[model samples]
Target: MRNLRQILLEEIPEFKAKGEAFLKGELGKMDFKKVSGGFGVYAHRDGKHFMIRLRILSGVLGKEQLVAICNLAERYAVPMIHLTTRQAIQFHKLSLDNICKVMEEGLEYNLYTRGAGGNYPRNVAMSPLAGLMKEEAFDVVPYAMAANAYFLQRINTYHLPRKLKVSFTSDKADGSQATVQDMGFVATLKDNKPYFKLYLGGGLGRNPRKGIPVDRLLPAEEALYALEAMVQFFTHEGDYEHHHKARVRYIADRMGDEAFVNCFWKYFETAKVKGGLDFSPEMPKYTKVGKTVEINHIAITSQKQEGLYSYYFHPLGGQLDYRLLRKISNLIEPMTDVHVRLSMGEGLYLVHLDGEEVQQVAEALDADNYLLGVEQTRSCIGVPICQMGILESQKALKAIVDYFKAKGNIKKSLPPIYISGCPNSCGVHQIAGIGLVGNKKKIDGVLTGIYDVYMKGKCTVGETHLGELIGEVQEDQLPGFLYDLASKIEATHQSFDQYMEANKEEVEQLLSK
Candidate 1:
């Protein structure tokens, strides 16, 4: 496996010269940089890829533009476009020669990919169902947009110990899953005005930990102030010695919650006294897809007025066809209040539709080779893509999904399961009900691909607890193996977690066998 730096040096011989020019402010073109967990591009390398993450107001884009963007990605980069976990798309591999043309196209579409990577503040992620969820107490989209606007063009907040992730949720539907972010704000109404329950330090990495609550409730006006205070604190007090320990979470953890909150409040009071912040604008509307042909995936016969009939489709490894996206956009356009919700699962949901539409949508998707379900269909960045990937998880996930379907024993109801390509666990497999981490195991003195089964935790971000591996199956045995595991879960009237916990020894023995 080649490090991104090595890959760049080998593939693009001028990489070092380009980087040197960039550093000297002499580079006429931009280039890429490899970071620990991910990769980034600097000022010179702004575009020239398959997909670019643009910082647009309200985080919205026109439908035709979106189609065009997808077409560009398919033509120049990868066939898939990823709307990142950070509210941006990763826009897979792009040829070095086409970067400038892609950037030019972005300008035409009112989109540009910058500040979506590096130590800078990432795109502000908000609940996809912000105002639409039945239980939402308030909408946080406005705050999210405000934050993005303030930080996007400005370089003041760019340099930090590590990347910052901010997420806001307006309801308990767990749309954005705030608890797993570096800075999180969940909305709750108080005295008729909306207040955000603030949390800090939650992150996923080698040392995964949930964020701690810093303030119970903060008026909307004070939210950005709180953000500034937190960032300031991180800049001044954060560890710079070890890169791994330099994240905001470490500072919060080292200072302790009480002290951190007290300091944050003090800064908030100072900012308020100085009259530096105000949030008088109405909450921004949910992100909209600009005008395009209407596409409808649901019909009245399949519509449901109540009871969890909707599912957000998180594509395995964040891969989606641009053409299919256009078709989906057309399918759902006629509905008055329909919105597409992007999930942390790296998938999107077509909400407020009935079962009929879902069936239609699913059928239409079949033509594109994208399946609909929440079974063993999960993935992480894999070989030739993510530098850290050891095995091909995207391919593995597809094979697993197909295998289960072909076995004729797949359950009507599926539990959450995730497959990770490597130990880095980018897929968040640790918290999954049934998780599989790809590894090479020696069988009959020959090394072969195998998936290690993990269980025993509520693996959704923030609420995650470490899971234990209970079994392993050869790559070829995964489908039948998973079927048996699912049966065990059903037979015991237990979630995958409970069954694994109860039969820990048995599971271990089975794996050893």
Candidate 2:
């Protein structure tokens, strides 16, 4: 059988040479690792694009620091900053020559991009309003930080069979989508004390499934220990011969839940006897901001809370302009306890805005067409960038979105829709209520972009499954196609999920023909 890595090397010889050099540590000023997804590095290459995923511990940062990073990025890298779904900022398209300088600058601000790449645990994500939210059962930010600290610089877990994703949500907001990650922790109270309800083996790829509950409840003190044991168990027992079968889910499936739990407990007991750190250190108490500043040319909406309003700003493609970044930094400068939250759709929210100041930010943001077009749509850097991408999905997404908006009858509250650039589904399109997976189709003797429609239920790595393609629509035909779908949804009076489930056979028959 042809190895996947060999195939990749045959296609991109330059990448292979770099990979060999990378393994030998010949490439200076660059960090390299073979992650579950693929090999990645922190060094810059000529005319090659790089993105830095900066993990921020503090809720706010100094304006000067923001300005400096922006200047450095614009001078040596891409002018725009990409904010990830995980509340981290990714500085994209930087030259390899500037990696050292960028790392040095990051140190001054207490920010680093160490584990953003590679197979290592990437960013540890939590609810943006972890402690401040009224509905929060417990603050999970500390636990997320603990996980990051524990895993950082640990190379053993970095080179795994596949990429790993983890999330924590402290409230009922469901903001973290905890049920669909490799390991998810949902905050809950047990015996009137803080704890987490653990879910494991959830992931999305070619095969999508929702995670199963390995442990229902783990006290805050045991959270880290349990996680460590779980990781160790997977490392020892996970399949290594077949790359596709190497994910944690397969292990859970083969071992069975009871045996998996038993193995986990045995490892936990051993680790406890070793006397390693059990929990993260306590974080400083967050203080409330005193005064609010006005934002101009933006859209501001009131939150469920009386004093708080959510400020929305469109950073195109989730790229933050230095000027805009500086302006946002200055606007919140006066507030003693300001928090900036990154949204999954590449939008940013200043969450704790006072009622009076919402108008100012809204006015400033309104100058640009932040609300217009499908530019707001999310897509992974497909095709030329990702090794796995077979088609270009980002630009196609923009076109699809524009077509629907032009129809003028688009539903105001459609279920979540996502478009995947390729089968890898890095964009998480599979989990969306209405998903479009990219494929090539011959239209009138010409190859054109067409998508396989996946609808109903969630598209997770294991539990949630990818649906049959209901139909294929030409690039320009999306508006009409979706309009018909909307009508069908209305006629059924069922949610998109329910309608798809009830009519699966019919939908599949229509698509196949």
Put down candidate 2 lDDT per residue, 1-513, tens digits, no spaces. Answer: 123223333433444456456545675323333421132233333325444566653222344555565666666645656665556676656544354356545655555555555555656666666665677787777787777666653623355655566777777655665777778888889778888877777667666656776555777887778667766766787787887888777777788867766776787787777766678558546444424444333356544445666676765445556677767777776754455765555566776677656666666665642444344556665655445565666666665566666776445334656667777665667666667777777878999877777666453222454445567766555545665666676777887667776876765554444
For candidate 2, the TM-score is 0.79
- Per-model C-alpha RMSD: 7.3, 7.2
Q: After superposition, how far is residue 141 of candidate 1 from its true place, in Å?
A: 1.5
Writing each residue's lDDT as its tens digit, candidate 1 over 153-215 gives: 453325677777787877765556577678888888888987888877777656766767654
Q: Model 2 segments beyond 4 Å from truth?
A: 1-47, 56-68, 153-159, 280-286, 289-306, 314-317, 366-376, 441-448, 459-471, 474-476, 487-513
Q: Model 2 Cα displacement at 4 (Å)?
A: 34
Error of 1 at 185 (Å): 0.4
Candidate 2, run of 10 with poorest lDDT: 35-44
Write down the lDDT that model 1 would get: 0.61
Q: Model 1, which residues run further than 4 Å from truth?
A: 1-61, 74-77, 155-157, 284-317, 330-339, 350-376, 412-414, 438-453, 459-480
